[model samples]
Target: MRTRGALSASGASVLLLALLVLVPIVVLLAAWQQEQWATWQHLLDTVLWRLVGNTLFLMVGVTAGVLLLGVSLAWCVATLEFPGRRWLQWALLLPMAMPAYVLAFVMVDLLDYAGPIQTFLRQWLPVLPDFSARHPLWVVITLSLVLYPYVYMLARLAFEAQGRAVLEQARILGDTASSAFFRVALPMARPGIAAGLALALMETLADFGAVSIFNFDTFTTAIYKSWYGLFNLQAAAQLASLLLLFVVVALWLERRGRSRARYSEIGGRQTLRSRPRLAWGVTLFAFAVLFLAFLLPVSRLLYWVIDNGLMQVDARFLNLIWRTFLLGTMAAVLVLTLAGWLAWVKRHQPSPSVSVAVRLATLGYALPGSVLAVGIMISFSAVESWLADLGVGIVLVSTLAALLLAYVVRFMAVGFGPVENALQQVRPSLVEAARTLGASSAEVGRRVYVPMMLPGLLTALLLVGIDVMKEMPATLLLRPFGWDTLAVRIYELTAEGEWQRAAAPALTLVLLGLIPVMVLTRRRSARLS
Candidate 1:
């Protein structure tokens, strides 16, 4: 047990953190009784069902597409041996660096009537009609290509981590290779696949840019339209609350489905490399997936860079690079500082209320960025009003401080999870030993915990930095004039159908995003080996 004083300090910390996190959510919810219900009923009678239907359809389609693409590719990469398999294992994850909205832009542009493909077709076969890119299903295909790598990375790591004897036992029972895979390997990897699906689904639900580009009115787009178009913040808040309910339900279903079985046969001698090979067709299938998933978007950007050449790299471009870097760095430092401190507080003093508060604080990552932006706008507007009554001038929106605060709220969980896990893995005996030697809490953290936690701390920083660089919706709304980062620039250019201009920033974002994924997988591969 900790000292009474320490316990009191921790309880206070929990209340403070939870209050900060919950105020925005509570404010959004309070819009219900304060606003008129005439518009709410009108929304239900008019476009709400259409929005719900479109959103649900996209979710189902994207989930199926990612599972098919991600799981099949993961199985092939883990089980089959062939040419280029070594490189493909990591290279397949490259699509994760390509944001779904960017991929949507590339796909729509290339398939349009005047693009290269249709132009070549007209030159050759002139009788055929123009390519049509209007169907909403294209959104599903585009999102899946970029997002499948979430499932691919997690499922591959999970498949590689399990012992091989489980499969061999299935073989001894006269099970076919396919049977063994379906009945044995798949179930064993359910936990990891479920986790990956949850992440992909969360992104799918939170998606605003891609759906907007494609003219598909999902709930996120509706939220923005309600606030920005109708100027009805109340309607937007209600839409956001409904969207959040959808996310919570989806997460619960995934968890319950995955809770059916427990995995205990974890470590054994036989491994993914040592497993028997299937046909070489699996390699061809994987190659085709890589072409569609990664190569298409990248090749389009490469052509842009090649054509524009040095003309694209000017003072304005350099400023974007600098501002993006500065924003990412600041956001990373803030998330790490708050997340590390909160996690350390929990480690030193564990109580049920504090644990629940920490969990609530982490839920921001699940809410859509547009929803968060609306909540933030409402909360800040109230503060500004109060300050005005106090005879003081204050501007929070369109300020760097507000933008960074939203980033921390949206992404702190990315930093906190690794910190908590790293701290948990340290032997409690080590801490107790340090305490017995009359070390203060800070001294014990420095002498005992810091060395072991440096890697995780660095990982949290890099991940949060990459996420901040790629973050779009909140930055789109909150950034002050002249504060356009790379992602904001990409969204702006892509929105205007200027793919050539967007290509430069989009590619830069991709390169930066790839660094963290590469580092993370390398660490995982080392651990599994």
Candidate 2:
């Protein structure tokens, strides 16, 4: 009877989570059926192919670049002893703090005709043409720099987990260092690398700010243009739907990759692998990666912030910062709470239906912010119209309510992943013992689970907070008129060619993003060491 009651309680909690997570998706799907079939048909006939191609190109480019740079850096830090190995391990993750869009701004500032890099080159060479006009490849390079850390962290974890025994065995078997890395270490780390690449690709597809500012024609940017630029929500939704299809493919690939590349821990104590000392050429190469990827963009932002006097910072800027903080904090709290619930359900219930619902809820993370913003608009419009007809006065569009909802939708997975991971590590017997002690399900959760999961919950909060602060399209579309967040302010300033004015907000976002990365990296390092 007690066992049955525990199971019943678990089922109920799972059901509650399923309902909360499914609501927005059902609303969005219903709204799509109601309005978007025709527009989707039109897109199929017109620009769909081009949008697909552009999105694919960017995805492929970004994924490949991130994998190469991220894996290399991880390998160097994990297996090779170097001068700055300790610092570089943590420093590699710093780029994640800088959003792709802000990096886009910095890249444009440095590479554009009027930027200092070009100015210096013109003075020296005099034959160098404008870089931006002459080369669009820089956009891809810039984006990869900011986004590669996703892959780096994952690959590093994989490498660390593999320990030194496997690699040493490969070496003893007469394999060269390069051969061992390629044949053994790389293959062993494939799952982690794939996970990271999937994240990077999802981020690439969802990117609107960077691609838009670079004058790129990816689906996300195009979706925004269709909606706000042309006043055609249906057309935008259609583009978004196409983007959603691509995201589905990426998610499927990630799932398949993980399933096939499973790694098992060997039952033995492990030691940290000593790294080979970097030769002169290799040292230069590592320095170059750090210089271009981290130093350049950060220096530009710092320069702008310092060059622009404090007097130039206005009341509006301060207000935006405060607003960003409040909204981001609120959204983070909500996301982490819901994520904890979902994670608990997944861990305790272990039913097919519950698992499917949790996975579906996380699908929102893959949807482009513009696409999700459009979905929110359509769904909110329908709700408001229905409420108005019922003589109720409720408006969700252009309000903080809509913004928070969108943030939750887009970033819930960020919180969910860490909490789910943490929860999985908790022994099932611990929960059973709590229940056997005559505690109710809720009580067990409060006492046993919540206390144990605090670190993960905090990690989730930090991840979601940083993501919300740097979030762009959803905030742009959903924010109330006369209300602004730091991200929006930065976008506006950068859009107007006022890069210096955008520096403060951009710096704040980078600083916030760095905190979580530092915490996670330190934790991982401690575990490995």
Candidate 3:
């Protein structure tokens, strides 16, 4: 009787946490049907189609570019022997530390009319008239540079896991290196590649900074414009609904592809694959690719930081850095805790209703920051009204609570993935052994599951921490009045054309992001080797 009570209490606690996490989404959907449908219909008639087209085009373009750059680079680093292959393997991931908006700012600073590239061109050519072109292509290129690392990391892991025996067998069967790679290696790496591609697509869809600055109208930007520009929350919600549908489709495709994938080599004499020698011509091509993809944008940021004397080693700036660190760390811990609990339930006690509910809860990740902000506003407003009706005074909107909830909603997936992946790796027999030894399910989970899943939980925390630190649109909208995160500060400065001031915080966020990437890479390398 006591055990049953305890189990019931535990289940209730889990359910309550899940409900709190879902409150804003529930409020948003309820409020949308209450008063905003008409304005949404109007906006849908006017600007919705254009926004949809631009967003779809950008998503497709960025997805293709990231996959190409990421997979090719992974292939080169993993399978081809080169002079700096070892360094390149890790260095390639550095771009991910740099946010898309920061890269966009760097590109604009370098390629604008009065910027370095044009000035250099004028100095050399001296005769070409001042040429100006609104190149959307540059946005695609800059975004790819920063985002391809997602694909690269996954694909490289896939390649590294592909043992030499399979490739050697193919070679012995009269297959040349190129043919072997095409027929055997690439097919085997599909799962990892697809996973990477799914991540890339998600980032591309959720992007606000890069698309906003580049003046390329995507669904995210449209959501922002509708909410802030026209004060049309309903319209924004409608657009968000559409965007959500698109994301659902993409995710479905990715899941389908993943289900069909049979990339894991289950039984084989595993040996490290020998690196293929690069011909001189191919080596030069590889260098050029690396230079254009990874080196140039980074070099630009370094130059601007040095040339403008923007590197601040001051106390006030240090305080901002500390605050940013605290916020990110706390948010990561909170998100991980909630995500771990939810994942645990999904894995152990999943039913159709629970699975559907979990999926619906995670949809917050796909909603635009502006849409989420509006949802939060609607929810908080209702709460405040309820408090007033009960003769109690409470302010809910524009508080730390609201901001944290938004962060949780936006980044739960980051924390969830690592924990789930970690849990999957632990053999089910370990838990079964504990159960057979007279341990309850709760005890088995607490003892056998949590300990083994700590690394994955930590990884998830790191991923969410980095994402929250770099997050802008959501932070900008939902942050308490006068409370500025590093991302918010950077975006404000850059928007005002104060690139020098922006560079400091931008650099700080990048450095913070790099720490986790370095840790993850080291741990991954150690395990693989």
Best by lDDT: 1
Candidate 1 lowest-lDDT run of ten: 268-277
Q: What are the per-residue Cα lDDT tens digits for candidate 1 across 302-357? A: 89988988365899989999999999999999889888878977877778888888
RMSD in Å for model 2: 3.3
Task: Give residue 425's error in model 1 in angstroms.
Answer: 4.1
**Candidate 3 per-residue C-alpha lDDT over 1-529 given as tens digits, one digit per residue, 9 for 90 to 100:** 2365554555665566556546655655565565666675776787768887777777778888888888888887776666666666777777778888887877777777888778888889958674542367777787787788878888887887786677888999999988998999888888888878777777778778877666778888887877778887666666666676667766876787689788666243254344455544445655665666546766766666787775446776776677677778889999988887777777766566557656655656655566567677667877899999999999998888888888888887778778878988778788778878999978977888778887888788888998888888777777777668788877777778777767777777877888778878887778866
lDDT for residue 418 in candidate 1, whole number 0-100: 85
Ranking by lDDT: 1, 2, 3
TM-score, every prediction = 0.93, 0.89, 0.85
**Pairs that collide, model 2:** 79-275, 80-275, 81-275
Q: What is the lDDT of residue 517 in candidate 2?
A: 80
**lDDT over C-alpha atoms for residue 215 of model 1:** 84
TM-score top scorer: 1
lDDT of each: 0.83, 0.79, 0.75
Better structure of 2 and 3 per TM-score = 2
Looking at model 2, residue 134 earns an lDDT score of: 21
